[model samples]
Structures are given as structure tokens and as C-alpha cells.
Target: MAITSANQLELLQTAEAVAREKMIDPELVVEAMEESLARAAKSRYGSELDIRVSIDRKTGKATFTRVRTVVDEVENHFTELTVEEAKPFKEDAAVGDELIDEVPPVEMGRIAAQSAKQVILQKVREAERDRQFEEFQDRAGTIINGVVKREEYGNVIVDIGRGEGVLRRNEKIGRESYRPNDRIRCYIKDVRRETRGPQIFLSRTAPEFMAELFKMEVPEIYDGIIEIKAVARDPGSRAKIAVISYDSSIDPVGACVGMRGSRVQAVVNELQGEKIDIIPWNEDAPTFLVNALQPAEVTKVVLDEEAERIEVVVPDEQLSLAIGRRGQNVRLASQLTGLDIDILTEEEESARRQAEFAERTKIFMDTLDLDEFFAQLLVSEGFTSLEEVAYVEQDELLVIDGVDEATAQELQARARDYLDEQNKLALEKAKELGVEQSLIDFEGLTPQMLVALGEDGVKTLDDFATCADWELAGGWTTVNGERVKDDGVLESFDVSLEEAQNMVMTARLQLGWVTIEELEAKAAADAEAVAESIAEAEEAGA
Candidate 1:
């Protein structure tokens, strides 16, 4: 191929056609062509020569040039020249100046033309990939309609207009099969740039997909009058969604359900007949949980906010329904509420309460040296621990049936003596285990807590300061979608996570690891951030 006047305009025409086909900028194609031509020119001349090419954008005229840099020491003989040796190219050539000379365009042979074509194709493909990535990166977390192209290894590849999306087998609803050219609606779960090209991962089982489908079907959700607070899905089996309405006149559940179940049914049909339970969202977690566990009457709801756990007591007859077939209902409800739920039947809850009462009675009987009836009376009166009986107001004990002032006083005295003896024993045990006086005097931690810490090898103040809040207060961790109990060193002492955090921070302050001013500044910053968030949320609500 010769770079003659007849073919000069053909280069620009080819660049425009290729750029239009790839949907990339024409300038990119022209630049690629220049690079490919430069490589061919280098082959035609000398590989050591610095050859360059430029194409006029409008006229497609190719310009070839040989560039030599003026340098003090000419190590690269073909590309660099000393200042005295560059006098012919320029009158004042300095040590850092470049001398350019026009050169004839190369006549590319078959092999050279093939290589140049490969270079241009590679560059054009890279530009196309970049364009696709930029186009889909912002479109993530949205719904797109695509046509199924093919299936490879159980993964469905879809043509999602200007890009290809892979819907992995795990991301598809149960038993969903698609043929070529089948139209599909998918959620754009992720977009990533990789060595191959842009990867757009599509999902049909994602909870957000259901939320978006509801948004499409329910006008109120799209208008922000109704908000989808939470969604939990079992993919093709069942799902739960909690919604709230800002307008008092609008019922979120009714609006989502639509007239004659039209709106929800639209979403369900798209999900391959997945069952959906629409519940009204409440600011109160327990109330929301009750709503989430609909169709099953909840007798009681006890929530432990710090642990993010809830206990629900339902009628025995409704136990199976609350737990669903294979515990799906409760699992979805737990996910919807973002809490670990433990559902118990009415009879089981009653039995558990009775057992707790008996256990508390036994503790009072053994520690306070009281008879069974007196211990039962103390347990029934809401004194669970010796600390409560020892430190509580004497009038609280006196309020118990048949308990006079003298009896209350005697009872308090015995309880205090028992607690003191236990504390003394615990202190001795902690000291035996190498507990330091610094830890004992640091405050906030009781004698039993110190013993627990010492047993756990946290014998020094430094060790206490290095301890994490979760290590001092028990917590639950999700492993493989199941909540696992994590035992804390001081959990038996009933130390909450906040109390543990404060104690550790105080220990750090006492050890000069942190200053009070830093703590105060951090607290102020956190308070300001929280205030800003609240203001933003209020504005959004309005």
C-alpha cells in the first residue's frame, strides 16, 4: 500500500467508518492509524531511527518525519546529535532541542501491512473497551432489558445494548432457563474493567432487583411518596419487603399491594412467581419485626438492641407458619429487620420463663441463705442478682409480701455480706492470676470482671486498653448466613458493649495513650456528622 495522493483521503474515510462502527471518537481511530503508519515507516527506514507520523484530520494527508534530539553526549547515534553536529538542521541548536526533517512515507509490503493492520485493530479494540466501560460504569445498580445471547457452563450471557452482561447461575432465580434471543430483565449488579473487556454482572435474585421492580410498578415509590426501607429475598421461593410512607394519607402497604394485588403481582410474575409479603415499616424495630412476621400472631416481642437480636413468642399453632417451610419465613424476616431472630412458641416461652424464675430463686436461696418460699418471694419481686438485693433500696425489699422493715434490713445485710465475700474471693483469684493494682484501681470494672480479664491473660492495664469492645462484651457473628455466638471475657458480668468501650477508652487515657482533648474533638466531630445526617434525612423526608 502506497501513501499516494489518491489513498491519502481514503485513510481519513476508513478512520471515520471504523470509529462510527465502534462508537468511539474519530480522533482515537486517527491516532491509532498514525501509530501504525509510524511503525511501518520505522521498518522501511532503520529500526534505530526515531520515525514519526501525523495525519491531517480533514484532508487525511500523511506526514513522516525523522526526529533527532540535540544532546551533549550522543550515545544513540541515529536519534541524538551533539550541538556542534546539528548546525545544518538549525542555527542555534541547544543540548535539549529536537531537529525534525521531512521524510517520504513508507511503501508498506504485505507483511508490513498485515502487522500495521493488527496494531490498528488492537488499538481500536482497546478504545472500544474503554468506551463500553465508561458507558456502563454509571449504569450499575439499575435495571436493564437485554436479549439472551447464549449459555456457557450454566451461565447466561445477555446482549445488554452496547455491552454484554453475564448472569451467573447463582445469580439466577431457581430453575430459570433461557434460549437464544429471549428477552430478559436483569439488575446491573456490578461493572468491572478487566483484561478481557468490561464485565457487567447481571442478577435476577438480588433483593435490590425486587425493590427496583416495585419502583417501576408502583408510582408512589418512584415519586418518593413511599420508600422501600428493606427487602429480603429467597430468590424464586419467597420474599419480604418493608416500606414506609411519608404522607400520612398514603398507606405504604396498600399502595404496594395495588388494587386487587396488581402491582405486587407484576413484580412476582417477573420473579418467576416468587411470593412476596409487603409489610409496613416502623421506626420501632420490634414493631417492624412483628410486621415482618405477618400471618403469624406474635404473642410477645423482646428485642436486645445492643446485640441486634430479637426473641418472638408466637402461638404454638402458628409456630410452623412463623418459621415457614424450612425456616424461610423467619430467615427472610431476620434479614428484612437486620436482626437475629429466635422464634419460640407460647408454651416454650412460658416454660423458659418458669425455668429462669426457678434459677433465680435457687440463686437467692443459696447466696442469701433464705428458705425456698422466701427465695421465691425475692425472685418474684424482681431481684435477679445478689448485687440488686445488696445495693437496692431497703424499701424495695420491704415491699415484698410479709416482709417488714426489720426483715428487709436483715435481708439486705445478709445479701451485702455474701456479695462482699464473693468479691473478696474474686479479687484474691484475680490477684493470684497476676492481676495488677493498676487495673484494680482503674475503676469501671468489678472484681468479677477483673477475675475474668486475668483469666483471659489481660493482667495489665496495657492489655485492657488493647482489648476490643467485642472481646469484653459478647456479640454474634454471621458465618455462612447463620449467627454464631461469641463469648466475651467479661460477658458474664453483664458488661454492655458501650460500657466496655468506655472502660477501654478510659484505660487508654489513664495510660497516656490518648489525650482528653483528642477524645473530646473526636466526639464533637462525630456529633456534628450525626447532626448533619439527621438534617439531611429530615430534608429528604420533607
Candidate 2:
């Protein structure tokens, strides 16, 4: 192309050297200047003429000059450089490469200088973008030292090494104020390129911020002597960390904690005194889970390894402490441990009651053909005696499984037979034991009296034979929803048929008490014992 002879090429050469000193590749600098000078040429000499800028690849040297053909009469002056001006360059140079007395470096009045300045500024900005992008993009998520540049709308602008970063409003520490030019460190959240420049995001509130502090304070973590498995944080409140060691002898938590908590205290001070739980991690699911639930002593951790879940059973008082206020502690624990944890409590009253009812149940199995599930149901419902279901009629017994009307009737028959046998055996056993045995034991009377005493809350032979005694009396009782007592109830047990009237007279006169039921029961018990003796004798005769 036709070249301009009177250009300022020295300025382009100087700019390249400055770029190399700044760690920028000289070739990249040359390319930038070439494009910028082309833009400047376009603005200076419009589209009517051809202008080109070239840089020597080896020297990173740039030359910006205009090229135009020599025509007889220049219709467009910028497009035609005269032939006399082309004489100094190659005499053999054709129309394209011919030289001319190029435009002199006389200061452009207004437009050209402005155009040149725009070119330099645009080129510099693009160069800076490339430089910053390469430097900081790889450094994302790393900690960096920066100086506070300004604060706007709660966001702080920091000048980190390569570019300015915006520390967003929310990530700032509570109630803390930062002034211009204040030195600080932060986590690099993001690095992005924009029209203006590279935009970097910074954070001071990330839990990784705490982990970083540990790395700085504890050499073991950086050197790989310890490892951090996880961290969970409630920025202004509490945090939990799960840690493990690379070396068997090293305790990851203790290393992070330092002697007497010095290292942890340093981190705490950095966090403005937020509580930290440094927990040791375990490959054993149960043990790891126990450590995750800090402060609360875990008696047991039942882990469902396949489901990745755990049930933490703690004492009743530890329940709240384990769960924390509103479940904050457990929530962080879940985050740190990677296990879903549920908590449970055991009560003594329920346990003792269960044992008591379980013992009552073996006898039931000996007689009833109920399934384990139904047996458990019965136990749960407090039904330990055959008498509980014994008096139940067909409809009530039908409510229990495996018992139809026939079965229910059979159950009632068995219950009655067992009761009868128990009564006979009771007297014989009493005779054998000699605790409360005598022919006078049969001094009670009546079958209905016996049934009522045995099945209708009578509970004892005394309740049957002495129902109307002084001890069985009450001063006031509800009858038809009204409180009333006959005053002679205390002497009701003194009833006798031989002196029925006299006994009544004696009871009413002396003690104002008598019970016909008691006198009857005493006679019946006496007769029951004699019947048992005769049956035994007959069986012996057989």
C-alpha cells in the first residue's frame, strides 16, 4: 500500500516497552495499538481514503500512516498523495507501495487530537480487561487482601490486586463500619468481565471464611496434617465444623482448637465471638453422629446406614439441648454430618408398666390361642386377667379378633370353669398352706353371692361375706345424684337368720350397722370347703 512518510511512529514504540514492564506481552500490546491507530485514522481521514497501521512483530514496534494513490488531479484530496511526494521511497514502488511526502505532524486543531485520545483510551481499556480476566478468574473462591475504596448503598468496593471487587451489602459483618482505604481480607465470590471493566464479588460472611481462618491459624490444615470435612454456620449465632485427620496421631479438632482454645478463640474473635463447635469426624456412622450433636451427651446413636439416617436418643433433659432452640443445633448438625437425625426420649413409667404387664401375659398364653399381635394389644389395653374378658358377652367378645359368637361363648365357659377350679383349688391350697384355712372358711353362703363377690368388684371373700360391715360403710354417698346414707350401714354385717330381728335390733341399737351379704358369704365359704373335701374323698375311692 502507498505509505505516509511524515508520521509519529516513535510514540507507538514507547507504549510497547511500558506494556512489557507491566507483564503484558509486547505482541498483544502491538496488536492493540494497531487496532486503535486504525480507528484514529478512520476518524482523521474518512472512508474516502485507505489507511493502515502496521507493527513489526519482532520489535513490537508500531507505525501508523496513511496510504493513497497518485492521480493527475485529486478530486478527493485525502485519497491522492502527489507523485512528487512518492519520490523518496522505492523508485520501483508501484501505486500500492509508493511513498509520499506524508502529512506533517503539525498538531491537529481539535478533532484529530480527540480522535487519537479516544483511540489510546479504548485500546488501554481492552488491554486491561484481558489482563484482569486472566489474572483473577482463576483465583475465584480464594482469599485476597484488598483496600476499601468506597461504600455505596451498603455495598463496599475494594481494590483487590487485579480489579475492584464489590462486597455486597448482606455479606458485611453486623454493625461494622469500613472507611476508605482500610485494609481487609475477603473471600472471592465471583469474577466477571463487563463493558466497563472486570467485576469481582467478595464475601466476608461465608462459612468458608471461618475455614480459611483455621487454615491460616493452624498450619496442620494447610500442610494437610488435618482435613476439614464440613462446616455449617449461622453467621451471627453458632457454627459447627466436622473435621478429620490425615495422620492417625493428629486430632483435627484439637489442632483447629489449639492449646486452651487459642486458635479457635482467634477465629471467634474474627467472627465477633460467635460460638464454634469443633467436632471430630468418624468413619463409624454412630460415632460421627454422636460428635455432630454437640453439647448434648448422646447416650446412643442408632444409625440406619443404608438410609443415611440416625436416631439420637438422649436423656429427657438433654432433648432440648440436643435439638437446640428451634432446632438450630440439630439443623447444623445435619448439614455437617450429612445424616438426617431424629431424637427420642424414654420414660421409666412406661417401661416398668410394660414389664409388669408382660409378666401377667405368660399365663394368658398357656390358656388362650391368641396371636402375638393380639396379645400385645391386650397387654397394651391393661387386660391381664381372664376375668377382664370373661364376663364379656357375645357382641363385646366379637370385637376381639378370632372370637365369633361360639368362640366367645366358649371363652366365657372356659373363664367360668377356670374360676370354679381356682376357687376349689384356693380352699385346698389354703388348707395346705394353713394361712387362712378352717371349716369355718365355709361359713359363707349362696352361689350368686359367690359369683357377685368374685366377679363384681367384690375382689375378696371378705368383700362377699362382710359387705355390710362398719369398715365398708360410708357417711355420705350419691344416690340418684343426691348424697345420702342410712346411718345404720355400720352394723349391716351383724345379720343372722336365727336372731334376725334380734341381730338387727342389736346392730341398730349398738352399732347402727349390719350386712346380710357378709353373713351369707361366711356360710357359703364354709360349705364350699366341705364340698371340696367330699369330692377328693370320692375321687380317692374311685
TM-score of each: 0.94, 0.55
Error of 1 at 526 (Å): 5.1
Q: Provide the overall lDDT of each model, using Cα atoms, as 2-decimal numbers.
A: 0.93, 0.68
Model 1 whole-model lDDT (C-alpha atoms): 0.93
lDDT by residue for model 2 over 239-275, one digit each (tens)?
A: 9988889798887888899999999999898787889
Worst 10 residues of 1 by lDDT: 440-449
On lDDT, the candidate that comes out on top is 1
Error of 1 at 389 (Å): 1.6
Q: Put down candidate 1 lDDT per residue, 139-174, tens digits, no spaces.
A: 998999999999999999999989899999999998
lDDT of 2 at 335: 76
**CA deviation > 4 Å runs, candidate 1:** 478-482, 521-542
For model 1, state the Cα shift of residue 83 in Å: 2.7
